[model samples]
Target: MIEIGHTPAKRLVTIRVSGKLTSKEYDTAVPEIEQAIEQSDGKLNAVVELDDMRGWDIAALWKDLKFDARHFDDFRRIAVVGASGGEKLSSKAAGALTSADVEFFLRDQVDKAEDWAAAD
Candidate 1:
């Protein structure tokens, strides 16, 4: 499952991912995400929690890659909060492909993660 939350100002978004992610979720979320970016004046900050996420479907992977490619510069910063050691590493690798500054935090450090993401 995937849930997306936007701050009242729409300058920041929280993406909560749990269980398994499917292409259906992306189909529903991508438009909302684009709207959020627009509302935020083209760039947004994000906090993505993957602590409860199991994995992604193959089709979802393709959708995600497309989104990333299209919106690489739409994010100002991304704080990835999760407990998975592997995800932390993967986020670092992904950061290389985007203009956004990316950081990783343990799930326990959510407050700090949010603070980092919220900073201008």
Candidate 2:
């Protein structure tokens, strides 16, 4: 499953991916992010929390790639928080989805990730 949220002021997007993600999830997520991006005036920052992420479905993978290619410039920064060093590659992979500055942090460091992602 994939869940999308935002800061109270709606300037920052927060994404949580758990279990296996499917195109259906992205179906909902993409629009929400797009709205947030538009609301942010094309310079949104995001924090993606990969919790119990198994991986993405083939269709979700394709959808994600397309979204990234379309909105790479809409992002200002991305912070991918994972639970372990094994997720470093996943974080890097997520970063490849945009031109924004991306960082990886362990679960314990999520506060730092959110702080960095929320900054200007």
Tens digits of per-residue lDDT for model 2, 45-76: 99999998988899999998899899988888
TM-score, model 2 to reference: 0.92
| Alpha-carbon RMSD, each predicted model | 1.2, 1.4
What overall lDDT goes with each candidate model? 0.89, 0.86
**What is residue 99's positional error in candidate 1, in angstroms?**
0.8
Q: Could you give candidate 1's per-residue lDDT for residues 19-103 as a string of tens digits?
A: 8899999899889888889889668999999967888999999989889999989999999998878989988988986899999
- Supply candidate 1's per-residue lDDT for 63: 89
- After TM-score superposition, what is the CA distance of residue 34 in candidate 1 from its true location, in Å? 0.8
Compute each candidate's TM-score over C-alphas.
Answer: 0.94, 0.92
The clash count of every prediction, one per candidate, is: 0, 0
Highest lDDT: give the candidate number.
Answer: 1
Model 2 has a clash total of: 0
Q: What is the lDDT of residue 112 in candidate 2?
A: 93
lDDT of candidate 2?
A: 0.86
